[model samples]
Target: MTPELLLLSADRVGVLVFALSGGIAAVRNDMDLFGVIVLAFLPAVGGGTLRDLILDAPVFWLEDTVSLWLALLGGLLAFFFTRFLEDFKPLRWADAVGLALFAVTGAAKAWGMGHGFIIIAIMGVMTASAGGLIRDVVANRDPLLLKEDIYATAALAGAAVYAGLVYAGLDERIAFGLGMLAAFILRALAIVFKLSLPRARP
Candidate 1:
């Protein structure tokens, strides 16, 4: 894919999953439609918004309305099909996908802007986790992003992989995909087996 298309694809997917996660959180909290929409919008764009502000770049959703629409779609899906989504218990998995995609995309964005590897990784983590932080805070729940679930570790691993691969002369598309996959797998395993970096407390 073209560079622009790749970035768009990753960003849009990230936003959707994050929105789904937020929607599920709202549903679990017994929130109404308005609250569900509000929750959906938070994690869907919070990380990117923070990234842009820190980078002094144009905020993404302001640059494109499709993201807002996608978030709305996610909210509507969760609202109308709460039972179906709940059957899958998608909050953790949605967050996992969102985290991975955002991390890779954020790393790519920073790299495109001439940042060094460290900043790219940090930006990736910020973009991956900021929205989740907002989601947990607004829902009055323990911030999973701050917990020992290997959440940020997975994001950091993805960003690092993307940055390393690009620097190693791999195609950006391949790098992006592999990076996202690495994160998703790590987080998914953690979710399934109660794993954590530095090892989980027994």
Candidate 2:
């Protein structure tokens, strides 16, 4: 597939997964249908919205309404089937997958826009973590950004790897896949082992 098509696919996957994560969060918080939908929509597009705003680009969901529909669908499905997912914790893994995909796609978008490495990395991290941060805050929980785990760090590492590989003349698709894999593995290991960064000494 073309680079644009590949990125688009990644974006959709990230949106859907994050939307489900958000929906789960809303259900856990005892939110109503409207609240669930709102929460789902937030994480589904929040990061990309922030990135586009920062980049002075058109908002992605506005450009193509598929994202909005997907978010609503995910929310509604989760709302109606919360009982089915009670034993399955979907949030952590879904968030990790979304973060990995979004981070790589965000970096690719920044590179395509001719941004510098620093800006690309920043955008990638923002795209990966911003939505979850917003979701957590709205759910009255600690944002993952403030957590001790290697959340944003994983995104940054993946984005850096992708940017470096592309700069070094690797195929964009290959770079993106490798970057996503790296981020997913790191985040998954952190989750499996309950790992976190060292706390600052008071």
Candidate 3:
């Protein structure tokens, strides 16, 4: 597949997972139906919206209504299926998956735009975290970006890896796979082992 087609397909997958994560968060927080919908919608599109705006590209959901429908579908699924997911840490795992996917897509978009490595990586982190940040704030939870949770760090690493691979002229699929694996594994390790970065002392 062409790089554009690859990114487009992967990007929608990221959207669905992110929306699912948001919906799960809302259900966990005991939100009402409308609240749940709002939560699901925002995180699904927030980061991508920001990235597209910054890049002067068309806003994704605006250009593609399928993304919006996916958000709604995710919210409905969470509303109906929270009980089934209770045993699993749905929020964290879904978030991790979303984080990895978005990081790759974001960095890829910046790279496609011919941005330098730093900008590419920065966009990746922004795309990976902004929606979750919005979710956290609205849900009255701590923002992962502000915590020593290693969340944004994982995204940064993933973005860096993808960008580096592309620059090295590796195949796009390989670059995406390695980059996503880097982010998801790091986040999974943090989730499983309670790993964290150093916190500042008062």
Candidate 4:
């Protein structure tokens, strides 16, 4: 597939993964079907919407309806099949995948739009974390970004790495792969080892 098509494919996968994570959270909280759908939809598109607004670009979901439909389908499937995922802890896994994918895709989009390195990095982190932030807030849980875990940090590192690689004349596809790998590995390690940054004592 063409580069643009590859990126779009990755973006869709991220949306579906994030939507499943959000749906799982809603179901765990005993949310109704509509509530589950709403939560699923929010995280699926929240980060991209915010990033687009910040960049003065069109909201992505408005530009393509597939994202919306996938999110809804994810929620509906999760709601009906929560029992099958009881032991899987789908939320954590899905979040990790979504975070990695979105971080790379967000950086790629910003770079394609001619943004500078710093802006691209910021957009990448925003795209990776904003949806989870909204999800946690709406679910009345502590936002992951505020936690000590290496969540947003992973995204920041990945984005910066991706941007630097691209600037250093690496192939875009290679850069994208490395960026996603970096984010996913960091997140996976954090999850596996219960890793966290040092906290303030105030």
Computed on alpha carbons, the lDDT of every model, listed in order, comes to 0.87, 0.86, 0.86, 0.86
Task: List, residue by residue over 61-178, the lDDT tens digit for candidate 2.
Answer: 7878999998998799779877775556765676687799889878888999999899999999988888888999999987867757888888998999999999999998899889
Residue 124, model 3, lDDT: 93
Q: What is the C-alpha lDDT profile of model 4 across 35-152, one tens digit per residue?
A: 9999898789899889999888888888699999999988997798877755676557667877888988788889999999999999999999888789989988777678778898
Q: In model 4, state the lDDT of residue 28.
A: 89
lDDT, residue 77, model 1: 86
Task: Work out the TM-score per prediction.
Answer: 0.85, 0.89, 0.85, 0.88
* Candidate 4 wrong stretches, greater than 4 Å: 1-9, 89-91
Candidate 2 vs candidate 3: the TM-score winner is 2
Count of clashing pairs, candidate 4: 0
Query: Positional deviation of 193 in candidate 1, in angstroms?
Result: 2.5
True-vs-predicted CA distance for residue 40, candidate 3, Å: 0.4
> RMSD to native for every prediction?
3.0, 2.3, 2.9, 2.3
Better of 1 and 4 by TM-score: 4
Candidate 3, lDDT over the whole model: 0.86
How do the candidates rank by TM-score, highest first?
2, 4, 3, 1
Among all windows of 10 consecutive residues in model 4, the one with the lowest summed lDDT is 85-94
Screening candidate 2 with a backbone cut-off below 3 angstroms (N, C-alpha, C), the clashing residue pairs are: none
lDDT of 3 by residue, 115-150 (tens): 999999989998988888999899998776688678
- What lDDT, from 0 to 1, does candidate 4 have? 0.86
